[model samples]
Target: MRIRVGKHGNSLGFVIPASVVRERGLEVGQEYELQLTSSGGLELLPVNQVIWKPDLSIDELLAGLPQEKLVYEDVPEYVPMGKELDW
Candidate 1:
């Protein structure tokens, strides 16, 4: 499909049709790697096959971290002062 490259802020961009986006399950904030093919074509690849979603659990998020660098520290309880809203 022919798409027009138009000015986006200070950069140029093209719009991906909604149909294509839905078919590919693309997310608005998902990261991708852009590559230039030898035949002068553009290719986009997801940085990770599994894109992070807001509903992911804390354990799921931490699973991506290296086990060697995992650290836990006890945080001191804070006393609210000056009409601070405490939950």
Candidate 2:
């Protein structure tokens, strides 16, 4: 689909289609990093930064630092599962 660059408050920008935004989970006023590919196509990426760790390696990183342990005692009883009943 082709979209024309239109003027908004003296600034020019293209209107992103609603289907494209919904499919990509994009929102209005959200930041995006735009870059030109080697083949001359534009790449639009979400500027929302997220930090994610795969596993306990992050815990190990924290363990290397000085930290205080919690003083709470463990609760002992396990809650048993109830028998299945038809609705």
lDDT (tens digit, per residue) of candidate 2 on 1-87: 899988889888998899999999998899888877799988788876533336778777688654666322322454434552221
Residue-level lDDT of model 1, residues 1-87, one tens digit each, is 788999999999999999989988888999987877799999787888544447888989888777565323222465556655442
Q: RMSD in Å for candidate 2, one decimal?
A: 13.0
Q: Which regions in candidate 1 have their CA more than 4 angstroms from the true location? A: 49-87
Candidate 1 clashing pairs, residues 3+ apart or interchain: none
Q: Which candidate achieves the best lDDT against the true structure?
A: 1
List where candidate 2 sits over 4 angstroms from the true fold. Answer: 49-87
Candidate 1, residue 67: Cα displacement in angstroms equals 31
lDDT of each: 0.76, 0.72
Residue 24 CA displacement from its true place in model 2, Å: 0.7
